[model samples]
Target chain A: NAGVTQTPKFRVLKTGQSMTLLCAQDMNHEYMYWYRQDPGMGLRLIHYSVGEGTTAKGEVPDGYNVSRLKKQNFLLGLESAAPSQTSVYFCASRTPRTSGKNTGELFFGEGSRLTVL
Target chain B: EDQVTQSPEALRLQEGESSSLNCSYTVSGLRGLFWYRQDPGKGPEFLFTLYSAGEEKEKERLKATLTKKESFLHITAPKPEDSATYLCAVITSSTLGRLYFGRGTQLTVWP
Candidate 1:
């Protein structure tokens, strides 16, 4: 089974443009997350969802919006992309049973690279 | 505020040489500590999880140990295939499942 899949493996967008990144998981996990990795900055959380129809803000959520309308999908939207928003984005998910036990081992997507010019 | 830090931004070792990476964190209440290895242009891969201080976990050539304020990832007899960035993250008890990640330690092993 495909554990996690992210759409648009690579993208180049002009400043002020809008785009959406899609993440789908086949594990039926209750928790999903969005993170951005920047050079020397590591991975920073953008937004997360505990389950379908729920979303929460993360460390860096100012320029991003998230929707978890279906249990298998989580989408990240950039209203007006900026150069600072250019980075490799990763999506992750974990089953509730493991997550409740505090074992934070996550199943991650390959990643989506976005470049804003 | 919760914070995680890793040391020696990068490391290089010979095929048979061994080394260790450090991850330090400060959080309100600890739930678990995780270790992941990431290759260039790929997502992080799960390695180990330490639930409390004084706990240790081992896998093949890697061993992870956790403490009250820090954790260590020890690699035994490295190989070129083991070269990658190692990341450490902390999951707090209060948060549902959010993880705070460190900058990560990049390692390269030459054959």
Candidate 2:
């Protein structure tokens, strides 16, 4: 069972270029998230979707846009690449939120490395 | 602001040596704490989740214990395959699905 998968494992883009990273999950999770990891900083959230056709901003959403057209796929778009946006991006999915339990375990995809020059 | 801090940015241990990694956090209302392992060039993988103080979880050779203000991931007799970065995250009451993560501790177990 392919839990979570990401496309374009590696990419290089010149400044002002645009690109999209695709993430697909087969577990039928209701929550999906996009995060970026840098050298000394831990993974920071970029955007998230609670379900199909729903998206919301996360901790670090600047210069990034997200779409969840289908329940199993979440796409992250970089309208204009910048040097600061060069990092390893990860996609994660989790089960729906309940009252106060249900261990919030996130199944993550192999990261996509993007370099903005 | 809610924050998470991990100590010993990196660690090196010989085979059979045991040690612990620390994750401290300060938040208004804590809902849950999570531990994840991440290899180089890969995404973080889930390890354990603690909901309240004095909670403990064990998997293979790793043991995670939680307190009111911090958590500890203890590795016992680790092998080379146990080398990875350990990340700690906190879920607050205000945010339902959001997680705040720490810088993580990189561990290397040498044989």
lDDT for each candidate structure = 0.93, 0.93
Interface RMSD of each: 1.0, 1.2
**Per-residue lDDT over A1-117 for candidate 1, one digit per residue giving the tens place of the 0 to 100 score:** 999999999999999999999999998899999999999999999999999999999999999999999999999999999999999999999875554586687999999999999
lDDT of 2 by residue, B4-109 (tens): 9999999999999999999999998898999999999888999998999999999999999999999999999999999999999988888677777899999999
| Candidate 1, position A55, lDDT | 96
TM-score of chain A of each: 0.96, 0.96
Fold similarity of candidate 2's chain A to the true chain A, as a TM-score: 0.96
State the displacement of the C-alpha of residue A20, model 1, in Å, after optimal TM-score superposition.
0.6
Q: List model 2 lDDT by residue over A1-117, tens digit each.
A: 999999999999999999999999999999999999999999899999989999999999999999999999999999999999999999999985556584569999999999999
The parts of candidate 1 lying over 4 Å away from their true place are none
DockQ of each: 0.85, 0.70
Worst 10 residues of 1 chain A by lDDT: A95-104
